[model samples]
Target: MRKIYVIGIGAGDPDHLTLQAAKAIGRTDVFFLLDKGETKQSLVDLRERMIRGYSTPRRRIVEGRDPDRDRAPADYTGTIADWRTRRSQVIEDLIAEHLKDEETGSFLVWGDPSLYDSTIAILDEILGRGAITFEYEVIPGVSSVSALAAKHRIGLNRVGQPFQVTTGRRLAEGWPEGADDVVVMLDAQQAFTGHPDAEIYWGAYLGTEDELLASGRVADVADEILSTRAEARERHGWIMDTYLLRRHASD
Candidate 1:
């Protein structure tokens, strides 16, 4: 039997690798990194750099292609189900080919796996297939939401105020009802437009030297954030960003 370890590498900095995550990387026989084509090659490169910086025990690096699923499917739920099935198959094949004799294999994920990451869910699908009997472990790392909050020097949640974390698509559809604070991730559509009255704090390429940060009322700074994000993406060929929006309390 083999074991699968899902480790979060944090946003974009190698230093964000947790001590426990580093230890796990060192012990794993193989490391699986997702490659989202050429545009997002930096993400894969960052993972490689982190492994080198830690001088972890020698391990093989396996590159896996991301299956870009259609986001605007007529049947969203059905499309997602199909996509996950295919994704699980690819992952299962990769693990079998690379870790046939190894007792433990690892996959490096961005941010904490528990937050908006599909790696664990995909792993579960693989397990369901009974293709491999494996124990599982998760090594957490600093999430982009935490890094964004720290970079802006603002607390994610106020005293006694509840917060919700969601994706750009959800925000664009409609601001989540009844949430005082909303943390938005995986946003390429500038979802802040939906909450024109909320205060917004945005950060891009966080933890990297080229990081960009901005904040203000959503109505006031939404355009600036979109413009800055586009420029940064063009300049760096890649960008990983996260933001927070809060509905002001009535006095």
Candidate 2:
């Protein structure tokens, strides 16, 4: 049997690495990276920096080309299912080739693995095939949603109130039922613009030097967020953002 660590590296901040995550990095024999190419060079650099700082001198870094998929497919669910299958295949190959028996391997994920991330699922798919066997552990880290709330100086929920976490696509369709406060992620379409009456606290490229933050009633700040997001995306060639939308709050 082999060992695998699915460690959360946190939103873009280097200091977000928890003590346990650091120990896992130090223990890893191989770091498996599925490169998405130069558009994410900064992210790649940050991961390399951490590995260099914490891993043992004998540590090996293995690279695999990440499978690309349609960003705006007509059948979103089916497209994503196919994509995940391809990704599982790539990761399975990496583990089979690079991670040796009795050695530890790691996949450094952005934010907590339990939150909307697919690495855990990919690993499970590999395991389900009965081709490889490995004991795996998940180490949680801070998420961009927490970082966004912190930077905005707000709590995710009102006292004694419930909130929902969802995606931009779902938010664009309509506000969630039974929740006045919503945390939206993977919102590439500027979905906040749809809720003109709601208050929005938005953050982009959180925990990085290029971070941007803005908040106000959606009608007032929607233009600013849209334009600013466009400029940032042009400048960085990529953007990672999330927001909290509230139709009502105690404060």
Candidate 3:
């Protein structure tokens, strides 16, 4: 059976990579990368740097073109399902052609694979078909949620309180009942705009040289975040951001 390591490479900072993740990377004979496109080439470059810096000198890097996802699909769930199916097929072909029996291959996932990432789910689907036989392990690393808290110097949850992690779309529907603390990701609309009084700790392009941070009552710095995010996206051709929101905190 072929061995595969689904390693979490951290949010953005090279320093965020865990020793375990580095070790896993070093063991890989081939590192599989899903090319998102030229717009996000910086991401591709960073991954390349990490592999060069940490992995064995002779390791091979395989690049597969990512299947495009519809950003504004009218049927969101169905569209995502189709995209994932396409992605899984691409990955299946990549593995079958590029890797040999007893050789190790790896996927360097952004942030912890357990959080928000679809790589693991897609891999599971591929395995369920039983067309490929491989042993796999997941290596955990620092997530953007943790990075957001560290950059802000704030705890995710208040004492005796719980925080919910959600996406911008779900948040737009409504805040979770009785949830006072929230961490929002993949938010393109500045979802916190409606709650102007809420305290927001936001970070964009986190851990990279172009990293941006903003915090204050949402009303005061909401525009800053939006403008900064827009400008960064325009400048870099891409951006990844996360924010923590506290509706009402005890002083």
Q: Which of the numbered candidates is closest to the native, going by highest lDDT? A: 2
Q: How well is each residue in 1-251 modelled by candidate 1, as lDDT tens digits?
A: 78888999887778889999988887888788767788877777888887776645567788888788996789977998898888888888898788866467898888899998788899888888887767789999889998999899999999988899998888888878777899998787778887788899999888887889999998899889888888888987877898999887750
Q: Candidate 2 lDDT, tens digit per residue, 154-221? A: 99999898999999999889888889999999998888888898999999999999999999999999
- What does candidate 3 score on TM? 0.97
Q: Model 2, 26: alpha-carbon shift in Å?
A: 0.6
User: Which prediction has more favorable TM-score, 1 or 3?
Assistant: 3
Model 2 TM-score (2 dp): 0.98
Pairs of residues clashing in candidate 1: none
TM-score, one value per model: 0.93, 0.98, 0.97
Whole-model lDDT values for every prediction: 0.84, 0.93, 0.90
Candidate order, TM-score descending:
2, 3, 1
At residue 247, give the lDDT of candidate 2: 88
The lDDT-based order of candidates, best leading, equals 2, 3, 1
lDDT of 3 by residue, 19-138 (tens): 999999889999999999899988889889999998897799999999998898899999999999999999999999999999999999888999999888998999999999788899
Please list all clashing residue pairs in model 3, or write none if there are none.
Answer: none
How displaced is residue 166 in candidate 1, in Å?
Answer: 1.3
